[model samples]
Target: MARPSEGAARGKPRKIVLVTGGGGGIGRAAAQALGTGGRHVVITDIDASAACETRRLVTASGGTADIVEANLEIAEETANVVEHAAAKGMLAGVVHCAAVFPQRTFARATITDFDQVMGLNFRAAFLLAKAAVPVMEVKGGALVLLTSGAVRLEGADTPFQRPFALYGASKAALDRWALGVAPELRDRGIALHTLTPGAFVETPGTRRIDRRAIPSLPIVPARQVGEAIAWLARNPRMSLAGRRLDATAFGHTWGPG
Candidate 1:
């Protein structure tokens, strides 16, 4: 684990925040924002090159970061990531943004596809929270699980057009699981919550989707979501635990304001 030069010399250990899928999109943005806020960010992603680029961006902004390359879909690897973050310094929070949004309708989707989406999207979160809660209990920490609007079934009657069967199922399962387990984690001084972007944001994954199929909804900047993640990490109040929070609805200023 590499320590910040200034903090190392002064014997001041910086708090660590672990970010999954830190290679690009919201993950990279969160790393940049958290790092700039003076937290030592430990970024894990399957793509070593992309994760390295995120580290460079963090460093350029005068923040410290370390990269770990691992596939979160693998149970062992997910647990190992938490262990690695704990070794760095005081582990403060975890931002889980690694997920696959494959556009597959039920008729076209196979069991293999189901496993792949659920494995990374939901199971990895379970494994991470199980591994991190113990380490965070020493003081306290936060876990922010990225959720999606696809989970709502009110207006999603036409699944064939949207093709979010697998993606929506995975996110819905994650939301229920987090809601069920959050209070228990809260008792242990660990705040667990689900967070949503509140609007569509262009990312490497979403860019693959056909634009015509997507509804004409408001688009949110990725940096705004990053700011929300940083805010949740810095302030893990019990009142906020077990809640599903929307980044845009909070009306909080971005960064140190």
Candidate 2:
């Protein structure tokens, strides 16, 4: 593993935080935020090049990171990434940003589309949490789940919401799954939380969609989500545990430690 630039470890060893989808967008920002906090961030993405770019940014910012390429769709690949991170010194937390939002309407979506959606959004979170629980149980850590406000508004069939049947269902499952597991993990000192950035984030995927087709909801910068992930990892407020949090409500209040 390549060594990271210098920071204050305070005579203690640096903790390691694993970030999925660290290649770009919020994941990249989260990894950098962890690095700034003096943790060794393990940035993983299916795209090796994108993960590498995140590593580059982390290193340039005087933070440390290790880049690993793993396509989370494959169970073995997901295990590979988690196991590799577990082997690192300490498993501080996981920022799971590896998700895809396909634009298939309910009428047009296929079984295969549903499978891919559930597999990536919910199944991967389950598997990653399973693999990390044992290692994190040793020292107590955070597992951050990126959720959706869509779950909050799925009952409403407004124009900006109709196209979300598949994606919303998948994320809703994730939100519930994470909450279901949060209490169990809390017994072991790991805080599992489901959070939404509150609006449509302009990622490579969202950029392809017709902006006019999306809802005119409150928007937040990708980095805010990133900072929120880092804050969630570094903060130990159990009051926020097992809850669905909106970024606008909780994110801006915390600063990097």
Judging by lDDT against the true structure, name the best candidate.
1
Task: Quote model 1's TM-score.
Answer: 0.92
User: Each prediction's Cα lDDT score?
Assistant: 0.86, 0.79
For all predicted structures, in order, the TM-scores are 0.92, 0.91
lDDT of 1: 0.86
Report the Cα lDDT for residue 133, model 2. Answer: 86
Task: Write the residue-wise lDDT of candidate 1 on 1-257 in tens digits.
Answer: 33363355578756899999999999999999888878889999999999999999998988889999999988899998999999998888999999998887778899999999999999999999989988999889999999988798875766333688788889999999999999899999988989889888888877888657546868998888887887788546577899888878756532233
Tens digits of per-residue lDDT, candidate 2, 1-257, equal 33442233355445778999899888888898888767788899888898888888888877888888888888998988888887776787887888877777778999999898888888999989988888888878889989887675645486666776778888899998887878988998888888798877777656776557555656788877787888887644566778777776653444333
Write down the RMSD of all candidates, one decimal each: 2.7, 2.6
* Position 20, candidate 1: lDDT: 98
Alpha-carbon runs more than 4 Å astray in model 2: 1-11, 154-156, 251-257
